[model samples]
Target chain A: MKLETRRVTKRYGDFLALDGASFQTGKDARVVALLGPSGGGKSTLLRVLGGLLLPESGEVVVNDQPLPQEPNEALKTLRKNGFVFQGYNLFPHLSALQNIVLPLCVVHGFSEPEAKERALELLKRLGLEEHFHKRPAELSGGQQQRAAIARALAPKPDLLLLDEPTSALDPVMTGEVLDVIRELAEGGQQIVLATHEISFARKVADWVVFLAKGRVEESCAAEQFFEQPNSALAREYLDGLSRYR
Target chain B: MNHPPTRRLLWSFALMAAVSLGLYITFAAVHYSWNWSSVWGYRSQFIWGWFTTLGISLGAMVVSIMVGFALMIGRRSTCMPLHLLSTGIVEVLRGSPLLVQLLLGYYIVATALHVGDPLVVGTVLLGCFEGAYLAEIFRGAVESIGASQREAARAVGFDTAQTYRYVIIPQAVRRALPGTTGQMVSLIKDSSLLSVIGIEELVQKVRIMNSSSYTALEGYLPLAVAYLVVTIPLSWYARKLERRFAYET
Candidate 1:
């Protein structure tokens, strides 16, 4: 999951979410952690990578090819990549199985039987097999988030971009989601995650990109960035978080 | 939470008694001569008119919903001309009075198109009038769905059409149910306005009966009850739908 962004800029009204932000990840880095405080550019950057938001300006090169300027073309290029949002935006009208099956059949062009088969397999893998027939409102928060993860993974995406996936969960629910994410990361699934869970990032992230105020404060291997300080911003950020524990 | 079935039944009976008492007092207060025999003589004519009103209202509802859905799609469409055209049509229809629309529509527009049947023209015009209002109701329902739902669909690689189809419209349709039914009720009441075109709906028949018998309450009172017969069940059904959808929420 190699990525190189050149002076990417995105704005929301009067606020700049990405202010000439140039970010890069090392080659073959499967688990890249985008760590930032709330109101920073982490979610926006993840959204841009997921092709859900087109940049206001600048270039995003993924795997040596530039991202497409045309909106449909861009989504086409990254169709293999999945995204999990802060809120588990499952289709409330659909049961867990249907939520996953809909995308498989409608978007991925899977036949109904094949889509159901794939959806059931994914639900079982996510420990939600017993709750497949339940709508999102019927499931607990942790279970719904897991269902959302299964929906994302059903497409067999090469890259999974998660934006604050645990931001809306309780501590226990967050742990449940993180453990599943860890298992996926360990299983060699490529993931680019923007999160606030420092310890989890330390455990699983191969590459680290610390952002604050819409700019990259630190970009390096996770090990060296944690052990030895690269910049004052990174050191302060890390120190403040460690002080909490 | 719901009241126990027995409690609900008791409350309904009590409320019905109160309404019936109020009606009894109101009618007793009026000095119009009691003419139950004359009202009975016109029962067959009134029944035919009631059926006519029922058919017209139901047909108009069907046409209105179709027009409403089409306008909603057009207003949200990517094509510039379609969006503008739908917006313009909705504004024009909703801004004018229904009475004027029936008059002008039948006299000029229907005549221009050589659509001479007053009943058909009136029903269609009533539908288009209510359709403009229904279009906005449908639009509000669609917008009530959060933006994240669409993004989630896209993340799964659902295209624009697929997003609306598999994810959006299903939920919107449910949310639209209550408001849609409310519009239907309004349309049913508004069908009385079609009396000006001599369609012989319930109100038109009652008006003629009143003039002939020189009695107001005899014909009009039963007409009101006849309307309640159609509309009360519809209101009850709408609430049922709202409850069923509420479970999802």
Candidate 2:
């Protein structure tokens, strides 16, 4: 599948979160990492890709069909992909198992037993079998994030958008969540992730898109971009990140 | 032999008993003829009145909740006109006095609709009044949920209705429970207002006994006790419910 965004611009009131950003990715780029500083349009671009936010202007075409203008049609097109948020945003009232089962049954029209079976399989696959009945509040941060990923994968969407899935976690917990994501990447799931973990991006992403001040500073193969950044801002960002490490 | 805290507790209990005895002595010194038989003679009327009050409260509670749910949705709807319309209705219902609404319902609305049943009119009027408050409670509860939850639901491919039914409303309902229980208790007390329209609820029966027996104290004392019987347990149940749903959150 190919996804292309042409001159997309999104504004929150007077502030422009995405300013005339444009890029394209083909099936070969299985894992694309949006690497940038905070508030540099990475999250905004990912949200736009996931149809969580509507751009004020521009076109997003997936598989040659433009994202529909109507809300309902846009939602239908968006449902072909899954999104994992940084906060894990699980339904706090529901058990971990029900979190995955509900969307399957309610949105995807799976029967009770069918939804339960799928949910159980995904939870176990994510190594959350013991915490299936625990609510989001009852589970630790790493477990919650894994459960969030499991919920996202339960539907087997064509694409996955992850917005800083490990940013809220500690280093150890971050590694745990990243391991799950790494496994998914190895399994050849088409994914886009917004993250500040430069090392994880270099290790897992095939392509890197460096954004600065809501504009794309550079987009290149991960290794090439890391070895020799195309923009001064990208160089400075990498330098600052390496110094912190 | 006793601990200091236990001795203090005994002293406090003795003081409370002394206060009660002094109050009783003061009442006895008043020399007013006590007409216990007059109030007791209408025991059947009071019981019937109690049930009628309960029935009206329950009926209004159900209708108000349904109407309140609709109003909450409308107020939060994407359509500007629907939101404005629901907001206006809620404000109007809540701004005006319940007494005025009842009078209007009994005189103008019921007559205009050609419905003469006092019970039905009373229920509708009280329901509408309480529904406005309930709508606000529901709105607060729904809005308190973080935006990420809605995003996650939509990300999972659920539409607006499904999001509310499965994700949003369940959490909102849990948060709204304490507030809702308070409104329900108020609703029971507010049903006493229906007596003004000749519904013959408990308060109205008490008023009748007062007029007939000319013993206001005896007539109203039992009425107060009857209301306590309903509200005390209801408030306790609300507390129980709050505890029951207070899961790890």
Candidate 3:
């Protein structure tokens, strides 16, 4: 799907989270990684794109349909996309299977048997068949994140938005979750993820947008942006990040 | 199973038995013209009174929970008028004493509305009183759930109502259970306060027996035991529910 934003600005009181941020993705770029500093507009832009957060001003259009300002209408539009939060946010009271089955049956209007079949399939695909009966509290961090991904993908959403999918995990757990995401990228799912892992972005992201202080510093192909960044801010940010790696 | 605190357990049992024996000896020595048979003769009246108390308590409990649910929704609503109205009601009901509210319900409301049934008036007034407190419990329970849970529900395509039905309320109810159970025990005890307004509950029946038989100890002790029978089990059940719903994260 073609996604574009025009001068989108979002503010929380005095702090501007996204200030006149504008960019467009080529139709071929299926996995777009939003690489930025912590307080930058990467998450804000991803939320705006997924219709999770309404921008204070300007436009976010996915396939030419402008995101609505009204909550009900916006929710209707957001139903077309899946969002995986940084915290995983799986239902603690629900088993892994029910987490997927509930959305499929309740929101998407699937029959009980049909929803169960779909949930079982996704759990099996995500290598969580043994954990189908476990609640989120019983699962490890990696298993919970995979269950969250399974819940998001159960409805077959057109677009997926992931906000720092691995920020809460350890290094080994991070690799496990990232591998699932990499597989989804290979499967041609349109995803926009806010991430600090530069190497993982280089491996999977087709397009990269580097943002800092609520503005896009650079937007280019992943190879081009990493190899020869156009702006000084992008170069400095990459340099600072590389030291930590 | 491992050591079992046997000495502590035996000490507690011995102490309880000694206390019971001392209390029984004191009772035997009182000699206040004890007339147990007079109180015992009015067994049917006491039973009817017990049934009335149970009925009112159960009825008021149901109404309070329903009203509490509505008040909770209204309090959390974005609409200013709804929020203000619910807040005002909760404050008014919770701010005043139940006795005054019962008096007002019987004297002003019952007379003004020309309602003759004292039991109905007492039940409704008591319900409103309990509802305000239950509303706070509901609010706290709902707020205790993290905001991310709601966001996750929304991301999964649930609308506001569906989110509450399938996700938010289910978890909130489990969290609220222990608190609600405590309130219910209090409600049963509070139902005795309805006696002043002329509802023939357990305490009122005890008062009648005291006046007729002139035996206060014989009349009041059984009343306290009856309340214990109701409340102790309720508290035990609340503890059970707390353990049952405790999700080990």
TM-score of chain B of each: 0.94, 0.88, 0.89
* Best model per TM-score: 1
**What are the per-residue Cα lDDT tens digits for candidate 2 across A66-150?**
8876788888877878899999999898999999998888878899899999989999898999999999999999999999999
Tell me how each candidate scores on DockQ against the true complex: 0.71, 0.71, 0.78
Please identify model 1 stretches exceeding 4 Å from their true place: B29-32, B77-84
What number of backbone clashes does candidate 3 have, counting pairs of residues 3 or more apart or in separate chains?
0
Measured by DockQ, the strongest candidate is 3
The residue-by-residue lDDT of candidate 2 on B1-249, one tens digit each, is: 446998899998999999989978988999767789978998899999999999999999999999899999999998999999999999999999999999998999899989999999999899989999999999999999888889888888888888888888888888999899889999999999998888999999988988887888888778988988998898898888777766666
Q: Which 10 consecutive residues of model 1 chain A have the lowest summed lDDT? A: A74-83
DockQ: which is higher, 1 or 3?
3
RMSD per candidate (Å) reads 1.8, 3.6, 2.3
Q: A148-223, model 3: which lDDT tens digit per residue? A: 9999999999998999999999999999999999999999899998999899999999889889999888888888
How accurate locally, in lDDT, is each candidate?
0.89, 0.89, 0.90
Please, what are the lDDT tens digits per residue for candidate 1 over residues B72-173?
988988899999999999999999999999999999999999999998998899999999999999999898888888888777887888888887888898
